[model samples]
Target chain A: MIECNNLTFSYRKATPILKEFNLTLENGGIYGLLGKNGAGKSTLLYLMCGLLTPAAGEVLVNGVNVRRRLPSTLRDIFLVPEEFDLPSITLEDYCRINAPFYPDFSMEALKRNLETFEMPEKIHLGYLSMGQKKKAYMCFALACNTPILIMDEPTNGLDITSKVQFRRFLAAQMNENRIILISTHQVHDVELLLDHIVIVDNRQLLLNRKTSEITSRLRFFNTLGAPDTDDPRLLYSARGVGGFANIARREDPLDEETDLNLESLYELCCRNPKLVENIFNPDNTSEHEQLG
Target chain B: MNNLDNFDKFSFSRFMMLAKREIISSKNIFLMELAVVAGLIIIAEFFISWSALPSLNDVKEYPSCYYSDSTCVSIIFVLGIWGFAFLANIAASLVCLKLSNKKGRITTFMTVGTQGEKYLLNFLIYDVFFVLYFFTVWLLVDLVRVIYVDMVYPFEGKWVLFYAIDQWNWMVALGTIALFLFSQAFYTLVSAFSPKLAFLKAFGLSYAVGFLLIPYSFFCSVVLIDKSFSGESNVIVIMASSVMIIYAIAMQLLAYYRYKETDII
Candidate 1:
């Protein structure tokens, strides 16, 4: 379990990015963290992993404060940052140096992941392209087999084929013992893999719901060429090359189930926050999913 | 947060792993720095030793700076020892800078090991390992200089490894080392506090410390210039060494605190 209790953080000479933010993420789920640019998505991820300390409250991983960075804690968590430097060394040498620290690290799993990514087992890190490096690193991060894995923009540098490979590789890596938090702008790349969605904006958690809950509560449509493209019921809509992608509350039992459109869902939450909030928490109560 | 306090407990195995990781990851950087420092020290030693020759001395109007009270004690050699300390200062600063500099690097470092292990690794690399490397390089150079000078240059008195106790300049050497350690520690703290431009900042602020070095330099000048002034004034040596060592310890503690509290940007 990961818990952020009344977390407040701000950079020097800047307004608070997250103030009194409280969130609890349970294990065994792949959480897709969504937010606008500069909405503190990366900051929140850093704080969760103890890379940045919070000004108030604390982040607890498995009941221990992450800031302590105990070996027991360190070995169980691995972060793949949006940007990282890999020393100019062979992949084998890199693993030899770093793998011993992580007790659960599995060479077999690494080899498997490498195979899945279609990367050579003995590629030199310095010689690989940016996308290949990302693949190699992602393979290594998964190989560590840490219980809590946090990746910022993991799919940013991936090509189309690599992105598909990434989703497959990540899905295979997931287990009940692991919790993966991915903060990314590439929603389509992760939609099929993520089970939970967390959206934050300007010091607020605008939305936190499981895919099942989101699909159960709302519906999505491709209505660009349809006659009712501007339907009155659309909570949000965006014109596309084909037509409009639409999101609307699922009001009737007979309403056909449609896949959750993350982009349209984000628009609905951002454009009419009050109505969305009413739909999710009609009683105007502070209670919701384990979130703040 | 129940076991957070227990996380501070030291682990010997973890510390060893951290050592292994740091050495392997930074081997290139370590070797490059060693090469640069070695070159500078070698050239400086070569020139100083060659000029101290009696054959080269005949052409001089005044005694060479290498001669102190008619003995071939090089001021440049003394300055060379001080130079190592300044190198140590930069070395220490660079190590601290790693803990705070790049966001990605800082994230890895901050999350890698326990604070105690990481702090000790930083201290051992710059303060212990690099110092040993520096001294070993200097001694080998000095050994070569001694061998070359003894074989070719005719001298009335043979030069010894400990610089001969007859000329008690060893005290000056020891005293200066302590002063340099203080400088190293101060720069380590400065870098820990400001990693963005630590080398430049340390260079900028180093001049402000000359006032503190005036008294020590005065003692060194007196002892080296006046051969009559030996270790008889051991009180000044003891006082200066104690002051500098204490300052070094204090600075190290401050640097450690800053490192412990560092948040990766």
Candidate 2:
């Protein structure tokens, strides 16, 4: 379990990027962290991994203060950043030098991941292209088998085929005892793999819910032209392609089962945050009738 | 079952692993540096032999024994080795200490081991390992020079290896040790603080500190210590050694603190 208790952090004396931000993550499931460009998604990941010191409060991983960076805590956590440079050494040599640090590192898993990603068995990491390097690094990271794994923009440089392969590889790697938190703007790449969705905007968590709960509470559907529903169940709607409106409505007894569209939901939440909160939390129903 | 709770304060195995990783990453640069140093030693020896041998014949008034004593040649060889070794130490420190400056490398390093282990790894590579390598190169170069000179000149007296070490003064030995510590600590301090231009900053700081301390120490020894200690030269050595020791300790502490608190950004 990783918990951030009232974490506050910033660069130098500038305004705090994260202010009194509180979050708790448990083991199991893949979490999709969604946010705008400067919404502190990367900062949150850094804080969780103990890479940056928080100005206030603490981040505890499995009851260990990450700030101390004890070996016991460090050995169980791995982070793959968006932009990284590997040394000019063969992949085998790189693994030989680094794999011993993690006691649970698995060579079999490494081979399997490499094969899945279509990367060569023996090649200098520096000689590979950026996309290949990212794949290789992701493979290594998964092979480490740490309890907590954090990846920032893991699919940014992947080709179309490699992106599908990455999704399959990641899905196959997920376990009930492991916690994988991926922060990225490409929601579609990870939509099917995410068990939970977390959206942040302007230093606050806009929405945090399980995918099942999100799909159960709201119904998403398509309509011709604009949504002209006179029923008081509409929450948010946005114009879609071919003169159709992508609509999200409160799930009623007569409503049919509809799959949640993460991209459209993300856009609606960004535009109508208060409605999202009211829809998820039934206690705040005073202004719940408002529609967009 | 709870492996997380089994946290060792200091793990020698982990430290060794980190050291091995550092050596592997830097092996290529190490080999290139060795080659460059060897080339420089050969060129320097060539110039020394060419310049001094011709001068010896030009001044015929001096006795032949003075030219063939081997003491002058040995001193020059030792001084040359010390100069090159010092340069190598500074260069190695600059390169090795900045390994964690880059964003990706820092993240990887922090994840692999404890900060204490990382700090010790830097010390091992930059100070201990480089010093050993420098001496090894120095010994090999001196051996080759001695053999080449013996074959060419057939000197009357025996040429001893490390002739100065045979009649070593305790004061000089202590001073040398203190100087070595001071130089290593100063380089580490500059490297920890100025990772981007560590070599340039360290070089400038070394000269600035040397100029200030050397003049002050000379003035104090001549004016005050000479009068108080009744012409005892060891007093100056004692004072200089004490200052260097304190400076070394202070700089080392500062460097360690800076390294511990350094943020990747």
Candidate 3:
């Protein structure tokens, strides 16, 4: 479990990125972290992985303060940053040099992940293209089999086919003991794989709900025009490529069930944060129920 | 379940692992250093031989005495030693720069071990390994030079290596080692604090210090001390060396703190 307790952080000469931000992640799910460009999603991931020390409060991984960066804590957690440098060495040599640091590193998993990504097993990481390098590094990261894995923009440099493969590979790698936190703006790429969704905006966590809970609480669909409904008020509505209107509304028991489209949900949450928060929070229903 | 509380913060095995990782990652750097030193040695040998040979007319300046002069051998040997030392400093600084300059590299390094282990690994690589490697390279160059001279133009003279060994004093050797440690430590601090352009920063700082030392020494000798000049010089050398060692220790401490608190964002 990773927990951020009242964490506050800010870069020098900049406004606070994360202020009194609190979060907790437990094992057994892939969390999709969503936010605007500068909404502190990446900063939260860095803090959780102990890459950046919080200005206030603390981040604890499995009951141990991440700031301490104990060897065992480091061994069990891996942070795949958006940008990384690989040495000018063959993948085999890279693994040989680095794999030993993590006692649970699995060569079999590496081979499997490489095969899944269609990457050559014996290529020099430095010589590969950016996309291929990302795939290879991701393979190595998953092979480490660390309990906590945090990836920032993992699918950024990937090609369309590689992105599909990456999703499949991530699904294959997930287990009950592992917690994967991915922070990215590319929500569609990881929509199906996400077990939980976390949305932060302006240093505040607007939503931290499981996919099931989100789907149960809200409904997403497209229609020719805005549907007339009073029980489930329209939280967000936007025009689509066709003459269709993409819409998200608070779920009601009497209404028919609809699959949750992550993109539309993200848009809805960003567009109507108060309504979304009220819909999710039972105690804060006083003001928002009027919209419903 | 992995218990982090049981993890050793400063494990010798982990230190060795980090050291091995560094060696593997820096293979190209080591090869480059070897090539540079070898090229320098070859060039120096060519120039020395060219200078020693008579100029077309059978009129040698010192005849056979040039090769046999202990003073000449000592000066050449000392130059070689200092040249290697200079190269070692460059190599050490470059290593530090490479390790700390890149965000990806620093993150990767920090992930592998505790801060203490990371700091120790830097010390081992820049301070210990580079110095030892310099001597090894020097020995190899000397052996090749000896063989080449013996085979090409046999000289009945004392070998430069033996001459250097004969001239070596323990106190001077200790002083040189202390100076080397101080320089390496200072560079390490500069690298840790400012990864990008570490070499430039260290070089600039060194130049600034060198520029100030002349005036400071002059002031100390002329105004500060009214006693004998030689006595004051001895006192200054001793005091400077002691202060350098102490400063080096302080730099290392600061480096450790920097490493521990580094947040690669």
Candidate 4:
């Protein structure tokens, strides 16, 4: 379990990036962290991983403060940043150095991930291109089998086929005991893999919900032409080349979950923050105020 | 495990793994250091000792080794260069740890292993490995020079050959050890504070930081030339050694503290 209580952080004397932020994530789910360019998503991720020191409060992973960075905690937690460097050594050498740190690390898993990513097992890390390097790194990260894995922009440089391979490889690594959090702006690439969605901006959490809970409460779909004026449940709409993408409230509990369109969902949350919060939290029934 | 009071953050097995990582990761750096050390020695031996080459004209040729005219056994100036070369190599090699001032590289290193383990591993790599590698290269290069010098000058005492271990003077060794420790600490201090353009910054900062070594130059003049040279009282030598070693250790501790405070921005 990962828990953040009253977490506050800032760079220099600028306005606090994250202030009095509180969040909790349980084991056994892939969490997609969504936010705008300067929305503090990466800062939150860094705080959780103990890479950045928080000004106040603490991030606890499995009941231990991450700030301490104990080996027991470090061994069980692996972070793959958006851009990273691999030592100038062969893949075999890389594994030899890094694998021993994580007791659960499996060579077979590495080989399987490598194959899934369509990469050769025997390789020089320094020689691979950026996309190939990300693949190789992601492959190794999954192989570590850490209880908690955090990746920032994992698919940013990947090609279409490699992105598909990455999703497959990541899904294969999912287990009940592990928690995965991926921070990215490229929502479409990881939209299918996410079990939960978290959106943050201006030090506020606009939405955080399980996919099931979100789908059960809200319906997302695209309609031809502009949205229907007669529909009372339509919450948000975006004009696209094909048609209008829309998100609507699902009043009936039995309503089938519609496929989530991440772009539209993101637009809705950004434009109608109060409404998004009100929909998720029933106690806050104050009429939704659309932010201009 | 939550209490962390008895938690063994430093595992011998884990440190060994980190050490292995350091060796493999910095092989290129070590090679570069080797090249530098070898090159300096060649310059010290051949280029500086160009008295062998008859001057083409009456005009005097400028000397590269201004300080004591560096030879294989000449002290101070050559040792300073070696220290600088070693510092440059280590700083350049640890580009993964914010040495290159890159966010991704630093985050990669900061996320792995325990803090203590990482510090210890870096300590070994920065200090111990440098000493061993430098000494090995020094010995081999000196041996080659000794052979070449012997061939050119067949007379018994024409040239001062490389001194064997048994012939080493305790006073000179003490001074050398102190200088080496100071070098290690200086590198750590400069590296911890200044990561980008570190080598140039370190050399520039060396002058302001030279109170630690200015006295040693005087000590070197008295004892460096003659291995058997001794003094009436060892107070000056002992004092300089004590000051240098204490400063070295203090700088090391400060560097470690800076390391602990590292935040991967």
Q: Pick the candidate with the highest TM-score.
A: 2
Q: Model 3, which residues run further than 4 Å from truth? A: A229-232, A243-256, A284-292, B1-6, B52-61, B98-102, B147-155, B211-239
**Per-candidate TM vs. native?**
0.89, 0.89, 0.88, 0.87
Candidate 3: tens digits of C-alpha lDDT, residues A1-292: 9998878788886887877777889899999999898888877877787778888889998888887777877887898888888888999999999999888899999999999998878999778898888899999999999999999999999999999999999999999999999999998899999999998875567788899888776777788765665534666667777644455555467777667688888877777777777778868654321100
Candidate 3: C-alpha lDDT: 0.74
TM-score of chain A of 3: 0.93
Q: Per-residue lDDT of B1-265 in model 1, one digit per residue for the tens?
A: 2363554477677677777777887788878988998998888877766666555446355333333323455454455556676687777777666655455445555455777688778767777877788778877887776666545543422333356445555666667767777777877888888876687778678766664357546645666546444455777677778888998899889888888777777
Q: Is the docking of candidate 4 incorrect, acceptable, medium or high quality?
A: acceptable
**Model 4 lDDT vs. the true structure?**
0.73
Two-chain DockQ for each candidate model: 0.43, 0.56, 0.55, 0.43
lDDT against the true structure, per candidate, is 0.77, 0.74, 0.74, 0.73
Interface RMSD, candidates in the order listed: 2.7, 2.0, 1.9, 2.6
RMSD in Å for all candidates: 3.8, 4.5, 4.8, 5.0
Ranking by DockQ: 2, 3, 1, 4
Off by over 4 Å in 1: A224-234, A251-256, A284-292, B1-7, B54-70, B73-80, B153-160, B164-174, B219-221, B224-232
lDDT of residue B104 for candidate 1: 44
Question: What CAPRI grade goes to candidate 1?
Answer: acceptable
- The residue-level lDDT of candidate 4 at A167 comes to 93
**Residue pairs with backbone atoms closer than 3 Å in model 2 (clashes):** none
